[model samples]
Target chain A: MTAALPDTKVLSPGNPPLSPARIVVLGQDTPFRLDSGVELGGFRIAYQTYGTLNADRTNAVLVCHALTGDHYVAEKHPVTGKPGWWNLMVGPGKPIDTDRYFVICSNVIGSCMGSEGPKELNLVTGKPWALDFPVITIADMVRAQRLLVEYLGVDQLFCVIGGSMGGMQVLQWAVSYPDKVYCCLPIATAARHSAQNIAFHEVGRQAIMADPEWCGGDYLNKGTKPTKGLSVARMAAHITYLSEAALHRKFGRNLQDRKAVTFGFDADFQVESYLRHQGISFVERFDANSYLYITRAMDYFDLAADHGGVLANAFQVTGPDGKRTGTPVRFCLVSFSSDWLFPTSESRAVVHALNSVAANVSFVEITTDKGHDAFLLDEPEFYQVVRGFVDGNAERRGLAARVG
Target chain B: MAGHETNGHIRPDLERIVEWVQPGARVLDVGCGDGELLHALVRRKQVDGRGLELSMDGVRCSVGHGLPVIQGDADTDLKDYPSDGFDYVILSQTLQATRRPREVLEHLVRIGRYAIISLPNFGYWRVRMELLLRGRMPVTDRLGHQWYETPNIHFCTIRDFITLCDDAGISIERSVILGAGERPLPHPAASARANWLGEQGLFLLRRN
Candidate 1:
């Protein structure tokens, strides 16, 4: 089944707007099966790699991106005309710098990007898969990425780093392949998605489905899009990403364009205009059906389920020799003070679990007004912490050997 | 006690503070669980290190981690550490929960070059609202444990902490009020809402 799929050469967002790292395709023809029993005759992964792979292949770093991010960790995005989401921290001289480590970022299987997703053609039906794509879990995403890593001829990663949903994948990578990852940094993430977070995602999905043009997630053929619903969904979700103080600072009581309120729902405030822009721009590159499927996948993520109900059991992983492990996958958990969605407490719970397993863990409570979005923005202190860690670790790896 | 070797992995917060220490500095950490900071200083910064901790488990853990630590209570063990042994006796976030902060401060100043202290600010507007309006101990992301289960014994406002530092004759050399990942915090309001708006406070001090 995996062999039937076509080549994936044009997946990179290049030229005009931004030059995002291109997705490198791999895999041979045999129906690649997912955890959900859904199979694809051919498989292609949209991936971007940075730095040079050493002869021994030990200096590779696998970075898993958040739900909305793509394979553009340090490059610019062509459609958005903006720098990569994490450009502030990953570059020639920055932490997680492309020059020192071979970094790989891939679009998840259920995403709207080059990877096979809800919009891909279904072998069973001659049309786009749409909602027919099998429900993929966070673990499934990790497994698919693992196969890609193997295809790249790499067996171990110097570090697995990410934040938010990407952080979840980092944790999965460490636990699922303890021998493969030397250091694990899962920032601003928890062992599992919280109930409140799941609730928020549900609201966004409902808002998208309620649009008159949704047509049950098959709006592509209707020549009409669920613009309003998708916009509202984006607006609501966007609120969760920012703090009240950040909003107040960015677009306080200022009016959209007029001095006084128009006394109508026509975006009277600047925040309204900003939110509308977010909604509109979001719909351009995103598909509403893919949003539904991806959010649902995040909602179902329960790391402890694979290792009984005890979260600690997940950390008590063994090495290849089955002895009590050395290093035991040390972790660093960072959380923002204003991040009401996942919050610092959620990160603490994960830290406690790591501590219970006697794993080396350091937790930081970085103060930020940007709320959950703090992870994406340019926070000097945050970057310093990351820079210190990455630089110190890189030195230990003797990356300096390559420099001189 | 076992002979110890230092691994040089200082806590990020402490890493920032170590740069301010004078040469041949002597330091003590109250509630110094596992002696990571002290061990790092001894190994990398060439400082004399000692720690007073209440938990036997903590002392043992520090011992196992190749750090030299004594299992004793911070509130009662100052006399054993002797005067002038430490040039800078540090209290990082342990000032709040001590049984006698006043006595601890007095003893800390007597035994070291100065006492570097840090704590969360209770006067932050959010804490006030949590107490006044929420009608329950506010469970924020920073202070997540329930009120009854919390380890914080001293709830000093930023103003209170500084005033106490002044009254104790501890001269403040450097202070940093850390806001979450990226928010900017002003120097004047460093103590006032740092507990609520910021995550923690770091200070360098000496006897006036």
Candidate 2:
């Protein structure tokens, strides 16, 4: 392990004990050789597993996380004391019902959580890698995940599932290691990054870079963090994660603290307060440059283009000689009706491609005002769909139903 | 069909069809919304089941429920599925909505050992009464949509379906008229009037 890297987990304050979460950290000794020529060696993946690995290990599910998510898929977050991103759909009795299938969720590479990222120091330089870290892509992220799974001795994953950036990883997993995944649930994602999404990411990048304190991504060493810039960046990206209807329902024309508008930049509106809260809370645990690298990776994701111009080719369910090795990746895509960032149209495009190949694919458009974050929110309908699907998959394998 | 389970133990018509499916039988269902029937077959009947569906929501729900369902328009995409990939092909309540029923039926029979099909009978008394007295499309519980907007592109009676099957050299293995849920009415004529003039036609067919 790099001397500059912390020996233990990223134990943040106010966070609960890791024991309650029971994350079995892997990748501590073997580093993944990245396609970018740089190797992230001695990396440790913090992950938690629910359920038994059935005799064949075919019942394991790989749960990928979105940009800011860590390995805590259904546990409580250590820093903010919040529940894991998809807790509503992934607990003992929940839809993903960890009781029936072995669920493994790890923090992605280039993340601030126990994973290796730019925020960690380089052993040679005795300084945080920061901008010195090699640029990674969504495909690279999936490769790292594959290594983690291989280390765990799981040959074929029953399913790979995630939403938004997590969904991007799910798609890459299916394409890059087709034989490993039996089913894929990529929610609120597109075949490729849209111009609009790219543009929004650009605005956030510019926000981070414009800060004088950013110091060419070396702000951490300078003891002068780019808090303002990163906060603004978070605020902007947060809006894209929500629908107009959700914002209206949550904030609307309501004032923040006082009765009337202060008529200044003092966050007079409730929405402003909410955004600021999101930004401030975000900056407390996240590294600004790590966000830059992860979002850039997402921006560069183009699954169909990588396989071929034909989107249908990505959905091919078989290898040469009609073998199931390269194919048999059943797909389930879910999109929220009000999610403007990655709307139902984006999901439909994926579904259409799967249809062209006559792939075993299913798509669900959850009727919710919660927008892109609906997958993470407390929506019973979304949970029901997920629970039904997960349970259904378990039953198909002749596995006895585990009481959730 | 008559000696099947009684009310409390009354099996869903789809389950009844699945119950008769031989173990390990490869089956494909058209317009399989949410794959409830396919899931049942795969789980209880131990059948290798796959399905084609149009609604993404249905596909998603079915897939989420862990069924092998593909999101595709059955009217045009049926040709893409491999021939003889299934022992039994089914088009339950979805045949009437297809743009070309005859073509789909032809494709279904050509691909499977047998095909199970069910459709709402349009010759039921309510439809006839609506056409004769009201002069408008009947919006009954079985056929719920208004005339111009319904997905039933090719409505047919039990007789029409039988003739098509016979003309295509397909033999009817079992045929029944179900009233309401699973109660069997008489023979072919029962399809014209049941459940106070609402009827459902089910057929188990085989290639001659």
Candidate 3:
């Protein structure tokens, strides 16, 4: 049931065994039944661990990665040679102190960084899944993570946390297994994808599909990659991650390596140059088809819709006989002031729903001009909020702290 | 009354406020300074406490102590909170500092089942004596700043607060007075003597 694929090593050539982390492979007998009703037979998950699981395994924290992020949560990324995406908040004495808690971050199912995605080979077809890959939802991603956690032999998670798409997964994890998650932290995320967000994702998908090199989502078989389309998609999506004030403060009409505008179609502004660099770097690391699948999954995520249109119903824990259990996972929601994509209003809606059900919850909207990406940056207020919430929950869980 | 110790001593007014809060009730403390009262309630009464702090440092300090608090302005943010979302909404010594004291009072009663408010009384004997003798706005220990520098723009006496509550159709369920040292005053409830002698006024009110 758990046999390894013969072509697993050659499947993701670009990944190249970057981080010294564990990679688990699940076979046909242990298939991942996705929301699309398609069963994914053989798949692999790459993950990194920090700190140590306590003797009772009560110190485990699952950190979900965002859309373009990988399992390298607090170390150097093997491919780009850049510092881990969340290094500012996941080190010794940091907000999510690895010294006190065991952290697990896995590259999601539809991601390309050493995970089961469109880039992985289909055991039946003996080729990449590509367009043939079943569309996955946020719930499917959490289901895969649950498997990973169970395989690691941890019965319960002390906390599950993430921001943006990762936060969506955290919410799904809490709802799907209310008793298993002790504390939930979903930052800068919504219970459902807004129409505007879905529209933006549609544009990105269209950009990739427009490229001739896409070759009907079979670029790998044709020995070509849709780098240009993927770059355009990344460039457009990256703009939403920042606020106008931050763009003005950083680049603001300044020329790019020139004293004056080129007066041509070239990148004449510093902002344009920066976005171009971001798009180029993104294409080098991400697969075009994988982006399409991941964005689609996010667009289809609506936690309340799956549970009779009542958001509180999504948090209800039921027994095997389908009776109410009356136990809820504690939640702490956070949002930034300037995050237009997933604003504070969305977090408030979640809080209001939790209140209706009498769930133990806390919410804080940190004042920041860093936009949606503020969660990834070194915002002092954000760090203090996370540290406080995590430490408080840890105390309540009776997990021993690391003494100085 | 059991005093919740933080820095080895509980501010007497805060101890009184904690006593008013029922154990296991959901409380929202508006303008919670450093979340001291909420912290005490959570530790002593085991209440589900939340805080809305206006100052960044206060929010940080509250969060540093692992208290749930959001950095927000009372005058604007209160409208966003759902009605009857909390069992008790407490505004401790921040009413006069708000841009719209009357509107803020209305929001407190609207958002919580009971609104617990504690405010400095401007009609205290020391404030009156200083104003009559010196012919200027008083500078007592409670109201220390001069008029030009004071944040208490809409400062009121106990009588004035009662009249405003009556005008707004709100019912005062209970009231208490505290002297200059933040200890309970022996004056009878709703008496003119309490207005003059009491340095602070604590009221529990609800919508009529």
Candidate 4:
């Protein structure tokens, strides 16, 4: 790392966070064309499941993972060996309640961690796809997921839920396959990527490209790795996931294991060391090329632009003034007050769009100092909202509890 | 009447508003507080209900009980809804809390086929007596806050509201002014006694 970035180790983690037990290739029957107009003959989708599908198969809940997330929603992470990222919300007797409904979470097509992405080897050339991988968007990721869900013989998903980029996928699922999704929860997300967000992603992308070891996205072929670049990119992106208040509350310019500053190119601050560990650990389970591709995918997400500049039209309704046939899907949008990355206003815009059609929708902005990561952490109000919404939707769908 | 509770159980203000909502009607309740009225209407009439509350506590409570509630301001968020969008747009005891009660009232009638609004009367005998006798802002069960920190702005008398309806071309389908026990008074809103006797006014209106 340069003097600008903190450094650490990456070659220690075992299993690399890729669970080989659940991998399925889709698009075998026909070619799959993406939003970028690129066609893929076939690709793999890595996934994990919880609970059991009812006899009618209408009890499936599809959980979409965010940019760095994988299919491990309620299980042990194969990478960090820590608990699943969403364990607080999606476990037995929890908000999502594995005891009741069948839940499926998949790594998006554009990401790594066993998913078919830029880091994977091309079947034709037998080399890592790297930059050669076809550019995929959020809709493309949902399309691949739709194929996988179809392959599983499920006609409708009971609920589609996620946060951040996962939330974007959730919106895409509701819009793309309207009939397939019965309910959706898009949390801490926007209908379109903001310019400021795109700028942050651009910085991360440029850092990886600037690294000499990146080698034009062919580091794997040359028996080299872009560890420094990927770590730096992770370091930069991680800061945006939090707020200034959260940063101050966490580190607050506290010195790191010393009385005073060493005045050298070392981590003199606790925050720097914490970020260093975060960046260092992230690179071990992630691929640099995959980071480039996923950030690009997020930068291109604009649900309104695809539907003639009216965000409401994207949800099968015209503008707020238009006559409404109403959407079949019930939606619950959520946001955190401290999340500057995807602020409460973005979620409200989606809520207003839904309200325009008088669609069945609910929205709540939970007050917290924890920032965007609050969704993954323990927030009682957010938890209660999820539980109530999920259970309420279940009650309306006429799905009875198999137990009790 | 099967899901209905005794009138003595709920607050007097919501009990009257809840009685006006018909079964299976499409409804939007603004400033719904903790959604007590919507909750009662949903349980009793099974109305296809939605609520807009301004406070996070209110939203959390409403949503936790399986109600479709969103956090929104009555003055600003009302414009986003389409005209004739709901069967009934309810603004119960919340009009005075708004910045533009007139524009908000106009939006309510425009968006819904019918609009039901209730407001605490400022020209009530107690308020007049409180000013003439003590020379201080009145604080009663209806107007529960002090003047310094009260959300009750645009406090209007029944006569003032009737004149507002006439000025805005809104047709009042029914107007009920409740007295000390929240009992519906025999005197109508246009009657001279309404300004002196009634504690609050509930109006059912439509666009002219």
Per-model TM-score on C-alpha atoms: 0.67, 0.80, 0.85, 0.94
The i-RMS of every model, in angstroms, reads 12.6, 3.6, 3.4, 0.8
User: Candidate 1's C-alpha lDDT?
Assistant: 0.72
Q: Model 3: per-residue lDDT, tens digit, A207-234?
A: 9999999999999999999999999999
Query: For candidate 3, lDDT tens digit of each residue in B36-68?
Result: 788888898899888887786777677656777
The fnat of each candidate, in order, is: 0.00, 0.52, 0.31, 0.62
Give the clashing pairs for model 2: A15-A78, A93-A404, A95-A387, A317-A327, A318-A327, A363-B60, A389-B64, A389-B65
Q: Output the TM-score of candidate 2.
A: 0.80
Q: Is the docking of candidate 3 incorrect, acceptable, medium or high quality?
A: acceptable
Q: Sorted on TM-score, highest at the top, how do the candidates line up? A: 4, 3, 2, 1
lDDT of 1 by residue, B1-208 (tens): 2222434455546776676666567677777865666666666677656566666555545533434344456676564444565688888778877889888887788777777776666766677788999798878765777879888777787777778878877777777776665244675444345556755666777677
Residue pairs whose backbone atoms clash in candidate 3: none
Local lDDT at B88 for model 3: 96
lDDT for model 2 comes to 0.75
> Model 1 chain B: which ten-residue window has the lowest total lDDT?
B1-10
Report lDDT (Cα) of residue A285, candidate 3.
Answer: 92
Winner of 3 and 4 under DockQ: 4
Give the C-alpha lDDT of model 3. 0.84
Residue B72, candidate 4: Cα error in Å is: 1.1
Give the fraction of true interface contacts kept by model 2. 0.52
In candidate 2, position B130 carries an lDDT of 90
Candidate 2 vs 4: which has more lDDT: 4
Candidate that beats the other on lDDT, 1 or 3, i.e. the better one: 3
